[model samples]
Target: MMLIKRIAVALALWFTAGMTPLKAETTLLFNVFVPRSNNFHEVTAQWAEEVKAATNGEVTIQFTAGNMAPPPEQLEAVKSGVFDIAFIANIFLKNKAPLLQATMLPWLVDKSENASIALWRVYKKHIEPKAPFPDAHLLTLFHWEGGQLASITDTKINDIKELKSRKMWALPGPPADLLKTLGMSPVATPAVQVGEMVSRKIVSGYMGIAPEIARDFKAGPYTKTITWFPRSVTSTSFSVFMNQEKWNTLSDKNKEAIMSVSGEHFAAMAGAASNKEMQAALDEMKKNGVEIVPANPDFYKKMQAAAQPQFDAMRKEGERLGVNVDAMLEDFIKESESIK
Candidate 1:
């Protein structure tokens, strides 16, 4: 009788276990290429929290603490499943994502928010159909605020003629190209090294950087004046994406939840955060006695003219890709202006 009782109890326990449902949980590995204190990284952490909330804890993101790969290798890292998600600078993928260069063109959009939103809308309408980066799932696109020219020398840039023969550090691509075309000796420099380059007097000034960059990179002390353009000279573009296989593993419900906090929403959030930082940085730079000089009308016009060849080149490339580059540009500008 005792043996029968023991068997009955075992059967009951087994039945109870079988009736209970198993919990499903997923954690995605996120590769952070930027510094932990950077605005972009902070915003991304918030985005991860939103995703978790939206999924009711079914999905979560785990940051890798530091970069898992080089900046240019991030896309491939995600595609190969080394990381489930990564932040990729579009400039590095110029050969594969040429159309993305539109966001980096001279005198385009002024605010980061507007530029990001416009890029997403235009990309969906025009560039998406081209099947760029078919190996990964793009979550959203974003760009930094327009960059201004900063000079360390006493002679501020009041006219385009003043820029002639002056060695200036610029971010590679359109910014450097435009500076070179305008008769300035352009040296390609990374943001982190700008302060060192300046202190060493390697260059007279630097272009294609925002005020926040100057503040964070410790370039303010060496920077005497900033030549502000109504529409910034150029900006850098970035894309947040996930591995195709990992994205496919997500249930439809979870996928929807994740996307709810992505796309244009993510873009706007990132831009607004950066804008706030930019304002604070500007205030700090002013306290340090860095003068903000407005660009002369003739100088601005000259810059626009020098950028014409860049636009033309983009159009030619668009023709090869069967995309109407003009339409995309018009839509991007219109969408950007329409936003507040």
Candidate 2:
């Protein structure tokens, strides 16, 4: 009787020990560089909630808003494990991620959602094997709605000739280069400085930003007309990535859960949110008496012709990076168009 009782007690103890949870919960620290009100930040918070639910509480995210590092330094912070996750603007990675520059070419994609998903697809198919960010695990890629041309002047840009010698603020990289090629004295400055520049009359107009950005940055009030392009003059691309060590700490199940809500799904979510915000901003701009007009058809043709060199430059650089630039570009356009 004594032996039987001892055996039963040992069995119970073993069973209870075996049934106990094997892993403690994991909480990842996310550093948000952009303002909390920004669409990317809002969507990231939503993504965190989705990750927690998807992992059944095994994994969670905590956000520390405000810049932990400058925009250009965010990737290095994650690489060194200062933060578990970050959304990095591709412009900052120009040297390390040359292939991704393809996303920034002018007039390539019309809609944000389509462009975002297409970016992810192309990255996976062409850029992934190249291992662009070996130190960080990429979660997703995304772009904002197409950027438009807005000027403080009342006259719409009806002729390409009008742009000659005109001073304008342009987003850095290809957009700025394109503006320069068109004979504009382009100031390639950060978006945060745009409002002050505009108010001080530092530039006559700006290009390569969505409507929401112009509004949020207080540049809309001084603007007289926004020239809508059938496709954007240029668009910015962003990447959400995790520290490699932090990612490796996650169990396979939790990793799968995180990725399930990432990639194309996350891109689409961010893009859709951006589209909503953009439309609202445009509406507000109209209500505030800003005129929104389409680019003149002849001007559009000339602009496209000018953009050819940009496309060529990107292809040349992509080829140097060993990417099948032609095929990749073709795929991206096809996928983007097919999404709608």
Candidate 3:
């Protein structure tokens, strides 16, 4: 009996000694509802892999799509550390951080890699440190090129005159403002519902980035004409935000590894994805008998002139908030031009 007891005691001690406690390494979770097939998802996955490799397993990340929570709640969730990290839409959280919307103003920058980089740089320098994002870390920001106007109606909208009195789709907020300026009534419809609405004739037309129309939604069947008006550029600015406490717990080396893969590097990937998607969408539209008509230069100039008042109103609001809106715009233009 004594011999058996001794053996049992020895084995238990040995087992305990050999067992190692699970080390608490940092892990980030991203809410990626957009299809994994999309370019953003691909690049984000690459970024995660790079971080894991760089940390040598010291840090890990997990990405989940389709509303880990609702999309609108993501901003406050990140601030409260509901997830270790979040990929948020800049405009969706504009109520929480209106200053960020300055860059999102329609037609602010030209559609080139330089434009994106410049805008992000300005945000990092002047915008991130503001009160709104104080609870989280700001990572990358980028924009999509302005998408063309697409219509399902028998009458094509080849000119501003044709667009007048057209029931056009608007993605809420500033988009409505843009439609109003164009003398069109805002059709308050989400992108997901676009197919049903168009097919039912609830709306005559809508505008969106080409890639979205081509790859994900198959917009060719619904829309018959693609008016090549480089309407308001609507880029969804994404941020790789970290929960404040979790971020503070990370070692400096790990933080630097994550940040290095962020900002302009991610912006570049985003821009490339957007460019490719746009081309693909255009091709799809053409196959569907969608006549592509470039907007007249005179018309474009006139629209810009009208939209200028809205821009001025925004700038004035920024000034009231003590932000240098004019300087930011000037800096953005300068940086965009400089990007080759």
Top lDDT hit: 1
lDDT of 1: 0.88
> What are the per-residue Cα lDDT tens digits for candidate 2 across 1-340?
9999999999999999889567689999999898778877789889999999999988989998567888888889999988899988888888888788787888887888999999999999998886466579999999888787888887766567766646889888777888877776688888878898899999888888888989998898998889888999888888989999889989999999999999999999988888899999999999989998888899888888888887888788877778888899899999999997
Which has the better TM-score: candidate 1, or candidate 3? 1
Q: Which candidate is the best by TM-score?
A: 1
Per-residue C-alpha lDDT of model 1 across residues 1-340, encoded as one tens digit per residue: 9999999999999999889675599999999888777888889889999999999999999999678899999999998888899988888988888999876899987888888988888999999997465579999998887789988999997677778757788877888899777766687878888888888998988888899887788788898999999988888888999999999999999999998999999988887887888888899899989999999989899888999989999998899888999999999999999998
- Lowest-sum lDDT 10-residue window in model 3: 208-217
Q: Which residue pairs come into collision in candidate 2?
A: none
In model 2, where is the ten-residue run with the lowest total lDDT?
A: 157-166
Model 3, CA-based lDDT: 0.69
Clashes of 2: 0
* Segments of candidate 3 deviating more than 4 angstroms: 1-24, 109-113, 129-134, 208-211, 230-233
Candidate 3 clash pair list? none
lDDT of 2: 0.87
Superposed model 2: Cα runs more than 4 Å off: 1-23
